[model samples]
Target: MTTNLTQHFLLDPEVVFLNHGSFGACPRPVFEDYQRWQLKLERQPVEFLDSRRGLAANLRVARTALAAELGTDADSLAQVTNATTGLNIALQSLPLKPGDEILTTNHEYSALEKTLLFIARRTGAKIVTVEIALPLNSAEAFHDAVLAGFTDRTRLLFLSHITSPTALLFPIERLVAEARQRGIWSVIDGAHTPGHIPLDLDALGADFYSGNCHKWLMSPKGSAFLHVRPEWQAMIDPLVISHGWTADNKEPGVRGPFGASAFVDEVEMQGTRDPSPWLAVPSALAFRRDHDWWQVAAECSRLAQETAARVRDLFGLPALSAPSLSAPQMVAMPIPPCDPIAVHDALLRDYGIEIPVFEWQGHHIARLSCQGYNTREQMDLLVKALGELLGLEQPRRKLGQA
Candidate 1:
């Protein structure tokens, strides 16, 4: 709030936008860079799309920049449109037979839950969902709960790096390591991890990790990456065949026609779609670096946690987990039992505050996302609106007004 970073974002001034976790609002500089890439592509459509020209090289430059930040080499990653796409590419490529198990948690994003269900229906792989207890006090508790579900038939381990429904940061490093030791393929859905947390994919040692650059990174929408370990890259297949396909693409050390590894080429080059969002990733990284985003993120985390606590206390609900276990910028504050749809609509319609209010696991939750552009005043407005709309009795002075 003190830094006054709101001016850099492209959000509408009238509405209080607290839903950065849903689909991120791109910064002005990053948006401009995205437009520039789009314009360049429009000007020379064939040249820009053609790998023989400079498409592959330009994408490599972007990937290398992102890889350096993610603590991995360029060849190990493939730029995808979004995390779901990247996840699907990884999920579909795995060879799951009938009765094989995919171990996950109940806190996964809904789309991915459906994706797993789809994969399960096709391959007859049983999706084993572990229910993590609320008010998580320790990382070891979470680790134990997830690992307990693993069995000899467990062929894959899939879970969110930062859960979408509950917004709790799962202790995945230990689980990933355990899964690897058990010969279980680890596929992580890191949709909210790229800029929200410090990420070192190699050090984490997951066999496959996919994350969105658009969510916490504040890049243009449709920018994300799927990282595969070099040994597993040969088994991973692209979602679409397109021009990048070659006969020996599944074979290791095979280079695509574009000169990069077959994994990068087949996965990245999915035909004539706009690559502007992926290309603009470097600008997003530079914006964060120049703006001292880590300090900003720390401040935002404070604001988000404080706001969540205030809301929870007002509603007389317990905290979801320890502060350290929650995401730095996003928190799912528990609300009193109510119709989530009505509350979500009323907040937007009457209060002009934009935030996600939904029901998860039979509990109503208002998931608040704190970005650099958000203010304490906006949070106050949200709290005030919730109290009034939920019919909570306020003190004599009322809330958010003198």
Candidate 2:
């Protein structure tokens, strides 16, 4: 059933689209809904943008629905273009002093690493990274690995809920608790968590968390949210100074610390932009809900597990991070010694397979993702392609079919 779901997506029919981890493909219905909001905006620009109450109400509805799913309140959230922007706001907003260290993992997204580096260089703070061992067995090992890097200079602990390069789900809950006990700010880059996995943001209890709706949530591009805890919300500054910026914290008395009105006024009241994608969040949620997304994601996760096993067996390489419990729907495996760019070119040129193959930690890593639209046959083809490229006979591993 999930394999048949390809008809709903606008992906190229000829290519085996396995790189859902990169830029996610939006389903037709959700894309239509995104366009509908854009059309509505175009119909009456002034009236739509000036209607503060109407816009706020629309955002409230969308955030309320999303918050219910994410296990957080609408008051704690603000819309952003993507997780990168949200993280930029968070990293820039915090009032860090010189010599304050922001600790993170080596598995972080490269873009985020650059952002943090810039912040550190600008503010005299330091970016400290800890290494996570491959073939990870348990969450405890991950937590221990990060905790081992903790020191007195570490003011904040930054990490991904689901890492980008390696595709491992960290033990964030325990890490957050550990950070809290040590008076460290816990910031999570949750760009891949919302729709792929079950998220309980309130229970997770991180000081700050940002994620992309455009990725796992299957929303149109440019839809994401930044969630700040009560204590940290007042400190958050908008990346751009606009109408929302004022001498006074507007409506601070009525709107608690980070309630929807205050948070929106501070972070969301930026000058001008198409707010359509964020408004279309409900449509994206509905698209998945109508399709029994939980079961679909579960089915895809099984295929992802099988794909990882197949790739590892084909390459004679160990899994990068996933071992006991496989990454849900996305996995990164190490390939044999080869030029990553050449392999990337060959995969796209010879094979009509769209996947990410890159260098990480001096190893050529290829991350494979299986969405609801992906099929087992496509995964088999990927295995065959890898075997032929690497000059090995494809060994049929005793893998359980998803």
Across 125-229, the per-residue lDDT of candidate 1 in tens digits comes to 999999999989799899999989999999999989999999999889999999999999999999999999999999999999999999999999999999999
The candidate that achieves the highest lDDT relative to the unseen native structure = 1
lDDT of 2 by residue, 196-298 (tens): 8999999999989999999989999999999988767767788888866655554333352233556556788787888899998999899988998989998
- Whole-model lDDT for model 2 versus the true structure? 0.83
Q: Which residue pairs come into collision in candidate 1?
A: none
Hey, what RMSD does candidate 1 come out at?
3.0
Q: Which stretches of candidate 1 lie over 4 Å from their true place?
A: 249-252, 393-402
lDDT of each: 0.91, 0.83
